[model samples]
Target: MSRPGQSSRLLICCTALIVCQFVSQLSQAGVIRDKLMERRAQQSEMEEEEAATNGPRFKLPPGTRVLEDVAYGSDAKQKMDVYLPASAGDHSAVRLPVIFMVHGGAWAIGSKTHNKVVENKVARWLPKGFIFISINYRMLPQLLAREQAEDVARALAMAQSKAAEWGGDPDQFIIMGHSAGAHLISLLSTSPDMVAQFGVHPWLGSVSLDSAAYDIPAIMATKHYGFYDKAFGTDPAYWRRSSPLHALNTAGAPFLAVCSSKRPDHPCDQADYFVKRANAIGMRASVLPQARSHGDINQQLGLENSYTQAVEDFMASLSPAIRRHLE
Candidate 1:
């Protein structure tokens, strides 16, 4: 109904409107993405700050004392914090059992003093006259997974050497860790000779919390996170060297592998496989499946619940003295 010039003018206006709308949508999407990134950055900062400064959230039982930054190696990260009960002193004859803890952050990040690492655990165990030790180790880009295990061994040796000074038993240590820490303790349990080389005596047992990396070669064979590759690398030989399942040859110590039933990765299945092998070789080993998330498996362990009770039962089985403390 219009002349050519008028029709052409109408078409240009329509195209301009469509283009403007598209640009507006793109701008909105960019803004949303920017906001999301900003929120994530803020959250990361908050977590770092908390990990740096936060202590146990619960009140310390009366007379509980802490010795911070007890160095095992020359590196600053190779330090541990020792928590002592009121009963622990040079003058006291009572020798407390030790719980040596390793924190988990994919083998790359985490601290000894993170609230989740020490809060409920310190509250529960210190009151029971247990000596709780939380350690920090050199992490990824600085040390490989195998090297980290060595750091753990070094820390154990140091803790054992100083046990009497802190009113703890040198032979009654229970090595416990969560996530990547779990993987490290599992590796050491499987390779007792490696720990022995570091002058560490035999520990009582090990408790591994929600570790899926027991079989490194198996994990690398399937779909996995990029972090695993970063930690284990591309060599199958290195995978075997780092794998707990592959490294396990002889009986070392009693073990408890606690796994999360909620993860799609089937951590329980891996735990079961490791336990089966351990039991076959005249070792006391078991897998406990819990309906907890990966983080909760570590965070909720020392809380007054069935989970804590079960762990304490395992501790009791280690020795009569430990049983008495739990009682």
Candidate 2:
């Protein structure tokens, strides 16, 4: 028979093993949930695209059309998709305004294809001709955060140069990205000088940064950003380089900074710091009216009437020059 002390030790060991197993299972479950959300978002996107021609009932305007899967690159390796209004009767010669849509995946696992909903919604649903370009850039483990931003910058430059081919005006380039993609575009707007290192022009117009992690250093406190530990070291200087909060200065893109109320619970406080910094330096900056969660902000961009008056009103406030140029 086993001694009581031996039994007690065995019980403790078994408990430890079970606890570890439970943690591992929970981690796996979290990953599965993430993948499922991504997959569903993609599925809804394809369905919406297929249904665009039907009407507002299908959540799209009839004149709007998609120019799927175009490869916008100076080289063969880089590619992107542009969704546009089909050559409707009189608008054939007109070049529409363009928003380059960047999908978020925490700087690691997202695709241009990941944001199909936004691509279709913005491109096909807007009554005024709005062309959407979704891009895939080199991401984490392979290149990390800074490189991911570079990929977006490169894609934007290519989009600007090649806009005419897709019936979009080269002058009006809006960088709209969600979550990590929002973070990437925010960095591009605040630190256009960073992309100058890559020989790309700073964007001409507004950056719609939706649910972006503005304060990356602040975000690093979360477990997921810990995954960034290897690339962005523990040092404040290194972390600052990746944070949009640190990059807010007198220069860069005019910003339409949209944050979800449900995320960070106090985005006004969190986003205010960056918005004020940008404004104090004379960079045009404004906040979006809607108070959506991070997921809701991006998720809604794929559907109609999601933030109806709020987002549309904000877009309507842009410079008439941009509106006319896009039209």
Candidate 3:
């Protein structure tokens, strides 16, 4: 029981185990470092990929093609592309009223140019004297959802600065987005704090959203969007701070929220919620139910989805003269 040689051997074995543990820790750290590097590289690649794609191209008035380059704000989200209409004077009837369109990608991935229904033949509306402007904004992981809302505010402000130049009336600003972008529009519509920061009055009109997220708390409560935890993390306060339903009021402007079905239990529950509350106040609100999936509701924009009629009807109802003055 007191053999000196045996004691030395046992000590050596213990030391070896410690050394092995240290080595394993080092390997794990290296793997983590490598993965982070890979992820950063992939994100860089994605930005370049988005940059390489030419934004929407159009035939400007008087047979001129003009691609406008605008420097929006401090962040890169301050960028946008303007498609001018052919031969119409600044604020002319033919110059096409501008619709500040935002794209959908769960507030993570999307480019304004990437979602051009007018470019694609799925449904044609460019000839309707409409000028479509899609803009990019900071997304989650890189920025908070609130910060992304700031980017939208900046985009609209920047548009306002050049309203006369683009023949767009400052009062006729039309805000629209899909999915998270729609959430963003709703957020901006309701959040007076965010709107006042833009240094302008509220906008004129809105057109179309498909299965957009309206209530942040309600959506997070679902806890089944596959990326909910990753997006906002598991913080309850964070969810409450970002929900649009919490901030929305009758003071918000008139807009339409569309869903796949008129029923309350549809997957796009936010649209239903918006319709219900909006109608309670006698606000000029409307909802056109569709039996399409979330993705189908959105991608259906350039296609033969039933949502087209709603968009057409809504747009047609707008006073053309008033739309022209939207900045």
Q: In model 1, where do residues sit more than 4 Å from their true spots?
A: 1-50, 54-58
Quantify all predictions' global Cα lDDT against the true fold.
0.87, 0.63, 0.62
- In model 3, how large is the Cα lDDT of residue 64? 30
Ranking by TM-score: 1, 3, 2
Best by lDDT: 1
Model 3 regions lying over 4 Å from their true place: 1-52, 57-69, 90-96, 115-123, 261-265, 302-306, 320-327
lDDT of 3 by residue, 114-171 (tens): 5432243212433444455767787768876767877888888888778667765566
Model 1 C-alpha lDDT per residue in residues 204-314, reported as the tens digit of each score: 989998888899999999866667877888999999999999988998889999999987667899999999999998889999899987777887989989999999999
| Positional deviation of residue 118's Cα in model 1 after best superposition, in angstroms | 0.7
Best by TM-score: 1
lDDT score of residue 123 within candidate 3 = 24
lDDT agreement of model 3 with the native:
0.62
- The candidates, ranked best first by lDDT, are 1, 2, 3
